[model samples]
Target: MKFLWTLFILMALMHTSSAQQTQKPVLHGKNWMAITGKPLAATAGAMIFQKGGNAVDAACAMLAATCTMWDMLSWGGETQALIYNPKTKKVIAINALGIAPTGATVAFFKNKGYNFPPEYGPLAAVTPGTPGGLCYMLANYGTLSLEQVLAPALQLAAGYPIEAQTANSIERNKDQIKQWPYSKKVFLTHPGENREAPDAGEIFVQKNLLQTLTKMVETERAAMKAGKSRKEAIMAAYDRFYKGDIAREFVRGCQEQGGLITMEDLARWKPLEEAPLKVAYKGIDVYKLQQWTQGPAMLQALNILENFDLKSMGYNSARYIHTIYQAMNLAFADRDFYYGDPYFKPQEPIKGLLSKEYAKQRASIIQFDQNNPRIGPGDPYPFEGKANPYTALLKKRGYEMDTTKRNFAPVHDIRNTSSLIEYQQRLWLGTTSVEAADKEGWVVSITPSGGWVPACIAGNTGVGMSQRMQSFVLDSTLSPFNVVQPGKRPRVTLTPSLALKDGKPFLSFAVQGGDTQDQNLLQFFLNIVEFGMNVQQATEAANINSNQLWLSLGGTKNDDRKPRPGQLLLNNNTPETVRNELKKMGYTLSFGDRTSGPINAIYFDWKHGSFWGGSSNYGEDYGIGW
Candidate 1:
């Protein structure tokens, strides 16, 4: 009897352990703040927190570290952040988006008698804005010294192990890196050796970048000692990067390389402090980056969703996916047609594009059984649009009409009965498309084009400048409209996002794909806001129907591979049983790997007083915290 009792106890204990292992890890602390990015980046933020810094200090530390660890989105680039000051209970948006160079008007290219190249040209680059933005944030909110915030990054640059993600990103951009001697030297092994990843503990150093950071630190410190106030000191730091010796050398490099940027342009660059875009959903208030990116469109999506009974629609069901896709189609149509920097054009008419009244009318247009016969922009606003009343109200007040009425061409249509049959036959064949979306509601669609060339030519303080112009589209249809105008920021697809629950900030999410920003964001939102899953679980979910091609490809019926006008891609997560049911309902389908971009999120649990952060495992990256 004693032996039997002991055996039963052991069995019970084993079962409990198994259950715990499968459950999501729960981390809690009131004063605890977490930064999710590369491990080294997180470590940098953790250092700040340990030293009595707040969230802003930690964020600055992490940003600097990422500049060294993930050069793709670092200094000499652009960064937009949505800071929620728990103390003040107020949220502020920091817009660091670069503007068009002084001499870079669309007519300049036309006068030069040169067509824009699909990748890398004079038109692809924007003024680097990260430095100015960082300076502003530090001066206004940070407690730690600039040297303290920069120490981790400088140390990492001096010598640190190259993480797997960094190695992979380097390998992917090898062709571009080869174009610049400095980049090749730092990123690759000697002459012709293939780029290699440093072993976990291997020390990797970027001597040039370290020197650059050191210079900035010294200049800023000297300015402070010279009796400059915090703001002046910060501005001085910016001057060191954009107008001092660094600026001179960069301009010289640009002139030597035939790039368009000048010292004046660099000196004139300034970060904007605009009101954040906000929306209310399910009693929670959500905010986004602004009109410069797809930040406002996300609120538009949520507003339309509010009109539907998503919980009853069943998660990932054809009906749920289709409804969400239609909403995105309408929102994106407006984004491409009307959204741009308001400072440049006073009559651009993008305000109220996603108003509730607008969403209700748009939601009414989605068909339950048949896919939309065509895809295009909805009706224009009834009145002359202005930038006031906020993006959320705009979503509620915007007009809704037949999208096909606009000149926008349709990419897919579900009206083709034959395409549906073919897709169904290949139901087992896999299709994939990887995408990324963030909670900050700032989407970046970086294309490799001419705008990025200056970065490579100038060599930003030893760190390679961004070569992100590869994401620009060269389709003749968009050519007439694609000119560099003064004060007009380039169109970007990098869309970071925020999700709200019960009228409060719920989650911050972002993905990393040039044109795949919105596509990835839509699917991820469905997984959580609709499907009811944790952050990690939602991130790991499959990608089936992307917002970009869903409408033209026949809703959620077409195979993701060779997506036709009315077909939709379905991944393994759709379930065999449910998939067959959809096929019987005349939907075309194909199987594929769940292709999604790397997603990073920090979820707030107000009820529990804790925060959870996670990075996508699908990518070679990890999220860490203390």
Candidate 2:
């Protein structure tokens, strides 16, 4: 009897572990729900649904909790999303990204002789959009009071056990935290001692943040009772944050600390509604987050991929990887040169850029033997004789160029050096300064306080405001015609996307990594749509990335910096069998990592009426629920 009991206990332990690995939540009875990333966030959403709130209400609640727990990914500094509405049966895209203060202008920096700064500070900081976005959702679709939705975040903020992932992410961004006194106080001790993970059941607290949340709930309630509709009341909360006493104090703090925000900029900030970009792939309608992100670029890549037989090429095969890289390069050629806000200027249609005719034309140019020194736009229309001027120019210029003529030139040559030598040379001479200037940037924010900040400095009302600053980096590197202009939003890579199949939503997804966003999204989409894999398997699949000129995974580099192009770095991990086969076909191979981007998604199946959500376990995170 004793032996049997021990066997039963061991079996139970194994079962529990297996269940965790494959676990998913389910909601039945004509409604579906799930949220990826944090378990606390999922619970918060579920609680809202139990209270008769729809998807919007649940999502708002989830957003609040995420803000409290997943500070690295969710905060006022990030963007917001709303994918579907049951009532309207229409998709809405909200631009919750922060913008620069009104005083921010290219001329301001040019006059100061200051190039763009490398990190987020008051200068790089835009108006936060999370608060306004949350209020908008609540006013339009929520039923529960803001206070109820925010309770979880407020509680979590007061204290929750520290996880290993959270600690690591905090440490990585320690430099950024050091800039803000409040951030330092909340995240670190006097000497910045590294704290160990809390015991399994311990609770932690964030007193300052809790106080901030409390004020917002009280202020929102008062405004609603005093002759304001839900939406207006929500807007009033935002106004209080921007135009009221709160703005004064925040601005004063900025002034004292040499920050660049003003009251007028806060007053003028507003969120815009934009039409979503849609595409058809294999008879299925696919949607993207519109011009606010690189959704169009993802669409372009997919359209180009439609021309290839990726499955037959086998998983992670060099031939398969090379073909995809070439296709991506073709797509990005147009993106880097043409894509931007359509409201301000007409964006050249990338569909033509990735058409079947164009793909064939570009594919024909791929040399399996000696690497081509440069890659061009190829023919935009293979059937027609209309030449792509971009391709012709690329051929004429080659890839390599003398840097002395450019504004920032390479002062020394450090080629064929060891890793340490390269690092030192890079730090000392900065030959790659121009190359360094061309990378992507992103800011993510989550707020559980119901689209408002707590009243620590706002005098008892709880609302926060965001500035719109993502517009600073719009235009092509090659074309002066595409320079940043007034009233134009930047070409962003931020996407909060969801995938649907067989008339049901299959994935609630988004990737957080600048230029790598679309590349990550594309790989995940393929893993599910073509390979028939589960969420975790698909997310963990090997990935590849290309930013127009250089393909990172493949063993070649198509340099955009010079006239003579073709240089690549192949990952050593690339399978030898695949490499030999590709080499026979004249392709090179290099080694790379799987760290393209961070993905968060919830997968739901209608047949089982079950929901499964998962965040990247590779990063700092916490999953909790009952």
Deviating ranges (above 4 Å) for candidate 2: 1-32, 111-115, 171-176, 192-205, 346-373, 376-471, 474-488, 501-506, 547-574, 579-597, 608-617, 620-626
Q: What are the per-residue Cα lDDT tens digits for candidate 2 across 296-329?
A: 6677778778767888877667777676666666
TM-score of every candidate relative to the true structure = 0.77, 0.73
Can you give the lDDT of residue 280 in candidate 2?
62
lDDT by residue for model 1 over 1-626, one digit each (tens)? 99999999999999666533412343333454444445666677667778876666667777777666653454656666666654455667777767666666545654654343123322345667767777777777666678888889889988987765456545655676666655566666545665443444557777777877888888879988999876677668778888888888666655554566678878888877766787777766767767666667767778878998888987677777677667776676666545556565434444556578777777788777755635544544643353342345335533333322221112222232235323222111111111111222211111111122113535545544433332222222221122346555655555556555654567766665443456666667667766766776666666654334322111111122111234456665566777766655445555545454555566676777666664555444344444
- Candidates in order have lDDT scores of 0.56, 0.50
Alpha-carbon deviation at 374 in model 2, angstroms:
3.4
User: Least accurate stretch of 10 residues (summed lDDT) in model 1?
Assistant: 427-436
Best by TM-score: 1
lDDT of 2 at 117: 22
Runs off by more than 4 Å, candidate 1: 1-27, 107-118, 121-123, 194-202, 383-457, 467-483, 499-504, 522-528, 543-569, 580-592
C-alpha lDDT (0 to 100) for residue 616 of candidate 1: 59
Clashes of 2: 51
Residue 591: error of model 1 in Å? 4.8
